[model samples]
Target: MNDFGSLLSQPVAQLGASIFTLGHVLAVTLIGLALVIAIPVMAMRRAARAQAQIAEEAASRARLAEERMAEIMRAQAEMQGRIGTIAEVFGSRQAELTKALSERLDGMTSRLGHSITEQTKSTHENLAKLQERLAVIDTAQNNIQSLAGQVVQLQHILSNKQTRGAFGQSRMEAIVADGLPHGAYEFQATLSNGNRPDCLVRMPNGAPDLVIDAKFPLESFNAIRAAAEEGGPEAQKIAAQAFRRDIEVHIKAIADKYLITGETQETAFMFVPSESIFAEIHENFEALVQRAHRARIVIVSPSLLMLSIQVIQAVLKDARMREQAHLIQGEVSRLMEDVGRLDERVRKLQGHFLQANRDIDLILTSSEKVTRRGAKIEALELGEPAPTAPESRATATDTAAHGRLRLHVVEDGE
Candidate 1:
């Protein structure tokens, strides 16, 4: 049991001890609890003051951000307005340039078409006029060719040599007929002297007269034209030369026939129609001309023949003057013969007048005797006077004596 009681007191002791310890422990614990609570209140008050400063700074930053966003929106609106104004101005300028180009192109096309139409019309008019002129030129050319052919035919007929010589002779005769009387010319005359010549000129006095002949040579003169006809063969050429020699023989024959002696012994003539032919004969055959002249043959051209005819006319005129002088001489001889016959008759008349005077004296003597006888007888017979016998007889005797003529010398008139 003690043990039990000790245990209980001990327990009390232990409990008291425990209670005191507990009280001590409780006081210490309370003091530690007050220190913990006061430290928590001081730390909590410092944390609330820091939280108030952080909230005021956050509100100031939000106000600054809102002002910056408003500035950006205003800038975007100004840029959009400028872009719309530039687009409207560019559209108006493009429409004006396109309308000006279209008007200029239309006007140029109409001008080009008008110029081409006018040029085509002018070219057609020029072509029609040229064709008309060509037709007129062709007609004129054909007429000219026909005229040329007719002229050539006329020239061929005129060149025949024999016909040409006859033409010249006829022309010469026609000209000479105008200047003189027809009786003065003798064409193809035959003279009284038994010579035939081309012409025989008569002088005033009746006598044999001058002679003239026409000489015409053909072949020698024809040879001068050999170039006109080509003599093809040698034999033909030789025959032409022989023909020339025959012409020379005919010239010599004409010279012999015309030249002969006449009353005056004058030269004879040979007449050639051309002067050019005369010149050719003289130049080529000088010896033949000299021989002919010595034979009293005179070669004469047309000009020289005319001069010779004038000289013959002058000689005929002088012959007529001499014939008039001979007639006057015969009349003077007859007048001298009549004067010789008148002188012989005057001497015979003087002898007859003397014989008549003697007869009258004898008659008077017989009458005286008769008176004596009568007186003797009258003694026987008475005598008386007769009255009428004495007065009447005296008147008759005076009238007979007055009728007689007297002459001394005969003058030219008697």
Candidate 2:
């Protein structure tokens, strides 16, 4: 029995030791669980504080945003009111600008219409003027055609020698007739040598007549011109020589026929109808001109001949004036004598007028005396006393004196 009781005691001690170790394990586990719970609670409390701080900060930021939005809204309202006022002002200004532009456009439209009307009128006037000018141009063209025909006829005439001579003669005659009076010049007049010159201008005071010959050497001159234009130099030289010979021959013939010692002027004119031919001769043929001058043959162009005729006309007029000088002087003397006689007659008439004036004054005085006497006779009444003898005698004496004065005035008037 003792052994068994010892074994139970050993097991019971072992069980107690195991229970103690279990208690320590339990205590350590409780501490660990408390610590874990406390740590979680603390973490939860800190998260709550952080959430409240975040909420407060969010509310402050939202208030600030609200304040900014309110300010923005007020500014927007004010801007809208300003925009409305600006729109009203812009509308009024736009209306004024539109009205001004309309008035300006109307004025411009009226001006444009008036300008167009003026331009149309001016265009019509210009067209009329242009038409008139065109008509004038047509008339001028017709005239030019007629002149061309006349020029052709003249060329034909100049081609023939006889017709050319006649043309020159007619031209010379026309110049002479136009410059000198009728009866002063004679055409185809016969000289003392029985040769009929083209013209003879009569000189005053029995002077010798002046002679003019109109025939020219035109054929050779024309040949020279043609050869110069169309032929070689040799032909031109030959033509010039022939022309010179022809001119010399014509000059000699004219000088022989027209120059007479006592019948014609000492110098006779050989008229060249063409001034160009005269100028050519003078410019190129100095020797020929000298020879003609020595022969007393004056080569003259149409203008020179006209000038000579005018000089002759002046000389004739001067001679006529000289011839009438004595008659004019005699008439002047007679006029002076008539003037003297008229002056003497006027003096005698003045004397007669003065005598008549004196006689009229005496007549007026006698009339006045007679008028006073009649007044006195009328004033006497039928019942009045008669005049005294002395008054009657004085009145009769006054009447007799008045009658004597009246007779004296009448005799003086006669």
Most TM-score-accurate candidate: 2
Q: Give the TM-score of candidate 1.
A: 0.33
Q: Model 2, range 311-339, lDDT digits (tens) per residue?
A: 78668756655554444555445545545
Q: What value does the lDDT take at residue 103 in candidate 1?
A: 54
User: Which candidate leads in lDDT?
Assistant: 2
Which pairs of residues collide in model 1? 1-4
Q: Ten-residue segment with the worst summed lDDT in candidate 1?
A: 404-413
Angstrom error at residue 235, model 2? 2.3
Q: How do all models score by TM-score?
A: 0.33, 0.44
Model 2 residue 133 lDDT? 49
lDDT of the structure predicted as candidate 2: 0.70
* Per-prediction tally of clashes: 1, 0
**Global CA lDDT computed for model 1:** 0.48
